[model samples]
Target: MIEQDRALYRPLWTVSFDEAVTLVRAGIAAAMRHQVKDLLVDTTALRGFPSPGTFQRFLMAVEWAEEASGRIRLAMVALGEMIHAQKFGVTVAFNRGLVNNVFTTELEALAWLDVEPGKGSPTRRQ
Candidate 1:
């Protein structure tokens, strides 16, 4: 399941990657439709880490499907502290043309997204 939250005026995606490929593809498509440049993704409910091949495929999908004109920054909050390092490695390795970071908490992820160069606050807290 995937849910989009615009609570803080930013598009935060809380996605369960049980069906990794399908949910991920759908999320990307939805982001494009919403013209989301800086997206926070919560992937803490995934059953398991994606294999190398699957990650590669996802990377390719992003390169091919995303717009060519603008930068897309993604801050992904992983499942847990133990898996955070491993997931961060995957993100670094496959982050072709995107600014992707893995975090253990939403606060950290949001902070990272806020400081990205040229990316001002699209969302504000009440």
Candidate 2:
């Protein structure tokens, strides 16, 4: 169950590239719908991304996010392998004027997003 504490969002997924895109788009739209400025997205279980298209996939997600929220802080919790060594994808997103980053743990993402643990109501999606 994906939950939200204030603007904090936590969703776990193991889907294909296409499904991931759909989720990213919907997730950002949902955060915007709730008027969230700083969003913490837990994607630690996110999987099935095509090996060679990770960069392009991330670009699409970031673009969708930008279209959804304009300027918003996005923190994501994902597996280590999903995190680029140089964080190039993150850099690209940040370069596009979106405050974005990826972490290996929820705590780290929450800290980055400045969201307190266990505070506010969680709004579940799907």
Candidate 3:
């Protein structure tokens, strides 16, 4: 789980596909309760091909986020060798509308999400 100062930012959590769906659900609930406007999801450390079940969970999470408020933005950071660019591209295509935006660098991601650096909302995407 990723923590941040509540006064300046919202908390971000890292989880595998197995845990992504659940986390997304909880995140949506929290966002609603807390009126969070931005969310950064760091997929930099995510490695390996997910099982069918995990993939399904990941899809569910994306869908949930999409259906929720458009204020939330997901920053998916793909670390070197952790995930292939082709696979990441495919996933991005499929979830284009699910997330506000995606990026390969933490700076770009934060910029796309309109998050200021050093505010505890650092997340990268591939």
Quick one: best lDDT, which candidate? 2
Cα distance off (Å), candidate 2, residue 5: 8.2
Q: Write the per-residue lDDT of candidate 1 for residues 34-82, one digit (tens) a residue.
A: 7666666665555554433455545543542343223455555655642
Give candidate 2 regions above 4 Å deviation. Answer: 1-5, 50-58, 115-126
Model 3 misplacement above 4 A: 1-16, 45-58, 80-99, 115-126
Candidate 3: worst 10 consecutive residues by lDDT? 1-10
lDDT for each of the candidates?
Answer: 0.49, 0.62, 0.47
Models 1 onward score TM values of: 0.54, 0.72, 0.48
Off by over 4 Å in 1: 1-18, 48-70, 81-95, 118-126
Report how far off residue 109 is in candidate 3 (Å).
Answer: 1.1
RMSD of each: 7.2, 7.4, 7.2
Model 3 steric clash pairs: 76-124, 76-125, 77-124, 77-125
Clashes of 3: 4
Report the error of model 3 at residue 22, Å. Answer: 2.0
> By descending TM-score, how would the candidates be arranged?
2, 1, 3
Candidate 1's TM-score reads: 0.54
